[model samples]
Target: MPTLEDEIRRLMADETARLHAAPDLAERVMRSSRSKRRRVRVAALATSVAVIAAAPIGYLTVGSVAMTGQEPTISVVPEPPPIDDTPPVPTEPPNLGDLGDGREFGHVRVGYLPERLQWSQRSVDNGDRYSITYNYKGDDKGSYRVQIHMYEEEAVQEVDDQIQAYRGEEDGEGVTVGARSGYLVVQNVGEDGMKGTPTLFLRMGDRQWAEIMFSPVYAEEFSSAEAVDAELKRIGEGLTSTM
Candidate 1:
């Protein structure tokens, strides 16, 4: 027995109740919105990652153009010093002529010799001084002779055609031996039973000196005066003294 106004109000109340939300409906809607926003942010981050990862590949594609203004670097190494492995050259000895065997005597020795000559067995000994004579083995007339004299004391006067007589002879020819200071004389001696041959007088030291008178035998044997001179010097150099 309700009126029409009461019926209409009851219908409006039913419709309002139908449109009303549940107690946690606003919270559920808020959570759904937050989840959608989070999904969007994740998608944006993935897209940014893809772009960042592609950057190095893009740079490599344009690598030559990017390095166009810069020069390429290079490494260099220096060369080492060369080694010197060559051997040193040796020096040669001097060329001197041939010399014969040695003959030793009183206070002296003759180093080189002439062939076929022997001691004449005639020697003169005067207290502390001596004289030795050499000749060809069978030539008795004394055509070629070598007389070597030695004195114990220096500056002994000429006794029996000895020291001073030969020391004073000069024929304008002078010679010097190596490392020995002495006077050498070559005299055109006509005496001593010789055939006017040449003589070589080498007087050195209180030593053995040969007042050599080879005579015309040597002059005939030699080709020139210079040859005789060279032979004379060779003889003198071969003479060595003990005193």
Candidate 2:
């Protein structure tokens, strides 16, 4: 039979072995506490990240509306206005017919002048011929001038070769003055390279010939060579005989 001390010792050894081999309660408690603290820290970090990410979105939304009371909208570019392309109207010409009656240069009677031209002077050149001059204040400086000359002979003795001298052509292109046949000649007057002053040479009946000259420096009087030519044609067509 075992002694009582031996039984007591066996009981104590069994309890010690169970305590050593059993699950460690204190270590389990420490592990659970550490897990809980880790969960808390992870939750706080997630909350902080969410707040930081939302802050930019909130600031941008508020900033856009802070300046004006409205949110941002797309800008539109406006179209340009239309241009005006209408031409200006021309001015009306003044009436000047019947201005030549009672005025005589040699056997030629003054018949007409353009609206602005005024009679200036008259002189008898030689004994049987004469000239009548007209003046116009058409521009600021130089004046528009016209001169009508007549000769007793049927030929333009002084200017007979004028056409040949300038154009190297003879019996210049035929033109009509009133009811009579005439010739046209253009000659440069001044140093300016512009088209020359236009002159009309015509035979009047069998007794005389006439020359009419139109100076070209009338700045405002004529806009183009065609306009001046038209006026000259009108003047030539209006000439009449005094005799």
Candidate 3:
């Protein structure tokens, strides 16, 4: 029958066949490895893209302020000033010359006067003008003369010589006196020339102007002419314009 050599060879052949793997086993392992590699590469690429996209925002927020203890400053705004609304016009007093003493006159004064009148005399011409007069106290026969001229110029459209008999009229009533616009002239100058007076003109700004005369014939003080035109309009409304 078969010997020892043939028996040993057969046993070896059976063991080898039992230990062999299927042909596709190695190929499957390789494919799996390649898929894993591809997945890893894709993940890494996505991570890189995300980091790149966030770089600008991170730098602006953190790097800008953190690096220099002082963040970027953006401030700007300013625009205002323009409102006038209009409504303001009445100003004209400044020509402060002659000061005053008995009845004041730097702008004006003599608020009411009458007591046999007597502030005597004064004249001052060049220092812008003045006149003052007043007389009647203890009369002697000169009756009255309450003059007062003060003028830094302005109300005179000529008509001087005792108001030239109220020149062609028109500038005679409309009195507000003491602060502006006044007129009430009356002139006659008859006792052989300077005898009937009665002036009163006003306007004290825009270069000043005032004249408040009243001469009832050398001092015959009121009697008629409507009581000397009601005491020359009550001394031209009690004058008083220190401007």
Clashes of each: 1, 0, 9
What lDDT score goes with residue 223 in model 2?
81
TM-score of model number 3 = 0.23
**How does model 1 score by TM-score?**
0.44
Report the poorest 10 consecutive residues by lDDT, candidate 3: 59-68
TM-scores of all models? 0.44, 0.47, 0.23
Compared with the true structure, what per-residue lDDT tens digits does model 3 show for residues 173-208? Answer: 656743456666665656676556667666555666
Q: Which has the higher TM-score value, candidate number 2 or candidate number 3?
A: 2
Tell me how far the alpha carbon of residue 36 in candidate 2 is from the true structure, in angstroms, after superposition: 99
- Report the C-alpha lDDT of model 2 over 1-243, residue by residue, as the tens digit: 887655655665676577884444444555686688666666655554555466532222212212222333222234456688888889533322333532565567766787777765334355556666677554422243877777666345655565456456452466776678776766664566675767777766666667777876542368876676667767776777665
lDDT of 1 by residue, 1-243 (tens): 997655655665665568784645544555786688666666655555555466543221111211222322322234456788999889543311122222665566776555566666555656456655567768774434555555555423443143345555533344566544344444555567544545555555643344444556645677877776676667678877676
Give stretches of model 3 more than 4 Å off.
1-83, 89-92, 95-101, 104-113, 116-149, 152-165, 169-184, 187-197, 200-210, 213-221, 226-243
lDDT of 1: 0.54
Candidate 2 C-alpha error for residue 217, in Å: 1.5
**Off by more than 4 A, model 2:** 1-102, 137-144, 163-167, 170-172, 189-194
Model 2, total clashes:
0
Residue pairs with clashing backbones, model 2: none
